[model samples]
Target chain A: MAKIFIIDDDEQLLRMVSLMLERGGHSTRLISNPVEGLQAVKEDKPDLLVLDVMMPGMSGHDIARDIRANKGLENLPILILTARAQEIDRETALKSGANDYLSKPVTSQELIEKVDELLSQPNQKMMPDRGVIIGMFGLRGGVGQTTLAVNLASALRRISQQEVCLVDFSPSGGQVALHLRLQLRHSWLDLPPLADLDWLALKGNLTLHPSGLRLLAAPQVPQLATEPSPEMAAKVIDLLQKQSAFMVIDVPRLFGPAFMAMMERVDIALHVLTPDVISVQTAVQLNRLLEKSNLKFKQKSYILNQVQVDSQIPQATVEKGLNARVASKINFDPNQARALSQGVPLTLTSAKSPLATMMNRMAEVINNRVAKRSGD
Target chain B: MGATHFGRNQLIHMDMFTDAYRVTGRVLVGAGGIHAELANPSSSFLELKDAYISRIHQPGEIVTHYKVAAFSKDNINFIVLQDRREGIPVGTQHGRSIYTRGRALSVFLTVPSFEISGEIMHDGKVAPREILVQSVGRYQLVFSAKALASLYPQISYSGDLILVQKDRIGIFCLDG
Candidate 1:
């Protein structure tokens, strides 16, 4: 049974709620005063908290805000209980960081069900006014992370109506520029030294795309495997974020110091994997590394990139192996190969294509998410 | 790394729960809170939507999940609620108005598998026998009550208020 803590001024209500949950086979702690209740929530660290809206000194909203502020308790699921079922009251509770709410007259079964539902969910606590960096990479070669990067950047450029940049961070060279057909005149190699590389200097090295998207292409030669220093990589990413409203990085699967520095600034990491045994195992290992390491992406997960019409393994099997849901799934497009050779993104050339439509929709979602999260 | 969360398909699953986990546990399919089935209070059994049964040892894990389940009221140990004023069932009244004055004292009662201790607010007299004889309800209020296992004291549960089955109380004690 889950350890549930309830904070309410009404002794009768507390007893009723406790008994109801206990029937559902959960152990509960009932506190009559708000002050003691808050202390117990912090010290005990229960699986969930049910708080009352109106108490003598501290309201439920205030307690929620305090719990959210506490570093260890920030993600604790809080259910607000209120005598007043007004819309405004709910709004207040949620703003103070309540996961869910129920009005005063609650049934025994309903209370049990809500508590279980909240327990089943993972807490998604997002801070306001933050920028986003979307990184795309696959542990196994030929899994289509570069393709996604190029096409997504093109689609985002069209949809966002704002500056969008696609960066190829492969030290040993990558297919990003090949897919975009950009001239190999400038790359991250052309940027000035780290201390001198301001946005203007970096801007001069970026190849401008016809779609108003910019490209920070990788070096043309595989022999010149010169990876940027961690500081240099962080500075470049920071500058890129300041200049562009949206940025997509075609990351190479190298968990070096540079990669770690860049990941610290990446808000989302989309680890692409094809439907195959080797690909799924590689993605699983990558997920384990991301979870164990102090990597700083808010969302470190994977996207299922279906490259073959007949995959070696099914999506269900892949999900079972990784123990996570695919953040997105992209089906293979027949014409994508021709588009890649022509140095044009599929999203730019074929808006009517299924792959292009998916990219466009994803771009729209990312755009809205960034805008809302950035507090626009 | 927590519970497996689906992007699109999981949302549809939650919508199914929204159907089952209504505020009243009654499937209010129609607008303005109307039950999908006609209410029959005269029946012996109560209906529960989306009932999940779990063992006491592994309460977090479900042994069986049901889309619907029925329970006979006569078999239930007791019922509890936050407020008695929501609507006193066709049974006897327990609470006096908030404006009335009362003295609080501890009471202990026992039912089938558990022994319960709670405070009762007596309005007029403090006589233990007179309080029990004068009470009119089959269900009595036990505020801040804790139920301990009759066999194992280590296993205990506490709740804010319990509308206990007064008729099932095998033993009752009142503190001076």
Candidate 2:
């Protein structure tokens, strides 16, 4: 029987859900308080937690935030149950670290299915450990760095269902956690100190999403910057594949130890650029920087972000100026940016957006690239 | 185990704007009133500093408490009371936007909520004349104020921007 913890301030709702789970042949613990719910997860370490979105004291969302911060119990599957049946509410719950978001008055069958789905998934350790390392870099801010990185990773997971890890390298300006609306307590900086590089130690630092994606968020604090040596990053990527299939690094534009080292071992470097002159200029400069590092330039591909919009520069003009064939182009959707700032990916927020389709298409190209590279 | 609460500190730790309080009261006028009496540290307009002024009203969840830096001679920084949270509706389906802009691209958000038609603005003016909400959410609004010029030195420059919501008013600080 799966041991589940239900946290909610509503006694009636909690009792109903708990009884439902119990009837479903599962052992359940119900807590009506956020603090107690957190404590239950930490001390009891249940298989899953059914959290309430709105709580009188500390909210389920707040408690989830604390749980993600608590490295020990960070991996616990959280299913948020809320009365606020709004898409933004679901997105908020997901971004706040809930594995599954179910509105209040959920059907007994659906709850059971969600619980079973969460519990049936094999533990993190049971998964296969192999993947590719792709680094996505954008020279300018608002060039859709996090958007591209999150969607690319999701598309990869959707197509191959393989292991994928998305690393947010922008420590100072890092929005990966914010973009995903992940209420993580600790980031890569919080990884337990390593005596030396090992697979288990590195795996401990990862925050796995219910979507089969793992994330290594940049440190939220600027002072806590951890620049893994190129050797260390390469080693981490190499070892992470044992647990993950593909590792995508959202490389921060800031030139430093981490960026330099990650670019060195990146199997494919996807340089993100807009049609703007400033973006192209930065892209060219970044391309040159990558070249000077002696990393294979031929493996690099240019992606024109915001290509669907009426840009200040024409696509043809940008192509002629950069003199590089664009590998892929993603459409511009204001809704996408709104969704992201509101803390949800395009795929999760609005699938109808053209950005989602392009990202999916881009994922196919990358998959083929990986296949070709593996063959070589 | 069935968990219960003892109601001792049930409402503890809900202070979102202790540093910068949230105010949703009308613009009070006092003749040289003391800073303590006139300024509600909880006012949302108090947090306006070097921010981009806009007129666009997009509804979303917002933080109510605004930190008061300094008040103008009239002992007023803004004209209206403001709600901390708003909900803008998404597409035909049920969803909304939740975000607040700070100086530069800094968006100050604690948790993003989904709703439609955000905090209503009865009638008021937003600075940077160009500011106007393009899309409306449950509690959030998308406003455009690119045409409005920056605020010049004036009385009651306490709040950076002002937005009128239904029965409630909001003073804001929007970043470009």
Candidate 3:
């Protein structure tokens, strides 16, 4: 049973609605005045609020807007019940932060159904329990960024029974679908407009991989001009966060809208760099760019990917050049290229490989950090 | 049961009480209005009057206010507007009134019969039952006639058919 608050000016209607809800197995509080209702909501914080659109002084829309603005009651589900019964009125009620709207003289059955629908929605208050987004960033290509991202995501999926999502935000087309060998008839390009993308749309666009990872592959034919905007990328991340327990994003080298958007929401950014002069120089510039742009991450870990066995630059030299300590060193593995050629992640095919073991350990560290953040 | 009180003050004797019709889902009425209730099924046909229908209906709305208006086990009626006043006035030719009034119109209707198959709850037990329900666009449960016929076959229905609302409807799917 849930606690429901009904705020309507009509005393008789309030009594009727309360009686109806109580019979429906919910504990309800009735407040006729909108001001008192707001105060009561702040004090009690009911799970659901049934508001009336037209009131004596304060309208339901204003009350809903105020409640939404309040940090404490931001996640409260609000249903607007009104006598106005106009298209504009319903739109305004939703615009003012109502989850749903219904006209007055609603039958008892309709009221309960709407209430059930609103309460059944996943509450924003439980968002901390949702997935954490980990982004892989490489200032320059060929640093084994996609390799790390794929293995990390696969490792995370293996570590937890929860769902994992891998998104490719590469402007030059992502290799996630190819690496996973996922045959896809659709990509993010097939999705409806960003404004119209919902859970179903997002789910429909994803291609399921055999490794139990959901992949939002990059466009088969890269279109930089038609790439998702920053806001669109943020919305996709937000939507994906709701469905998966861990999201591993393979971001492109460019710091454009999509890359920056993913950077903004990433809980942890793994800065992948090779032990090479050019890569180290690019990492330093990227770090400086992050500092100047104020695109903050909860945690940033510098990962040194030694793609070559005999490296000209040493780990110490790379660290000194980047001005950051290397958090993890991924040794060059000869089987990595073979694994990529076979369209399988090294972590999946060679779980006992040294590179896979290191990736799994990194995944564990990231998981622990996410758990600690959520607990806090 | 002797006397039962419903709503706030309405009361009726057990003998006079008719089988209750329960609304199973949120049925959209007019544009934004919703009609959901539990009450005795209408004895006769449900009427769509100017006053009750006006509250939910709006002018220039895409969805018709009274399409597939009444449903019975035998047939469903589609309301086709014959004439509507366009809010225009004309000078009297020879003392006879010649003006167009608003909000009044005639409709041509045809009742097409259909078969419905579904289940209902009786005495806390779900059983498969088939009854003819009227396809009224007003309520979510369009099985108006069949719902009444299956639930209360003995009760003589009179006046407008009342839609029976149920609290624990196990399965109420309309197949025609």
The C-alpha RMSD in Å for every predicted model, in order, reads 20.5, 21.7, 22.1
Per-residue C-alpha lDDT of model 2 across residues A1-376, encoded as one tens digit per residue: 6799998876887899998998766899888878877887898799899998655456677788798778676567788886444344565676676666886558897787667655543233322224667778866877887778898887788777777888875656467777677756656665554456587676777776767777887765566444655565656666776666677888877776667777766666778888898998887787687668766632566777884468778766777778865656565776775876677677655767878876765665456435433432
Query: What value does the lDDT take at residue B69 in candidate 3?
Result: 35
lDDT of 1: 0.68
| lDDT score of residue B139 within candidate 1 | 51
lDDT of 1 by residue, B1-62 (tens): 01212221110010011111211122222111111011234565655554444333222223
Worst 10 residues of 3 chain B by lDDT: B80-89
lDDT for each of the candidates? 0.68, 0.56, 0.62
Q: lDDT, candidate 3, residue A163? A: 92
lDDT of 2 by residue, B139-162 (tens): 223222111112311111111112
Candidate 1 residue B166 C-alpha distance from true site, Å: 74
DockQ of each two-chain model? 0.01, 0.02, 0.02
**For candidate 1, what is the DockQ-based docking class?**
incorrect
**How many residue pairs collide in each prediction?**
5, 82, 24
| Ranked candidates (lDDT, high to low) | 1, 3, 2
Q: Which stretches of model 3 miss by more than 4 angstroms?
A: A1-128, A222-225, A368-376, B1-176
Q: How close is candidate 2 at the interface, in terms of C-alpha RMSD after superposing the true interface residues? A: 14.1
Deviation in angstroms for B38 in model 2?
A: 88
How far off is residue A77 in model 2, in Å? 42
Candidate 2 docking classification: incorrect
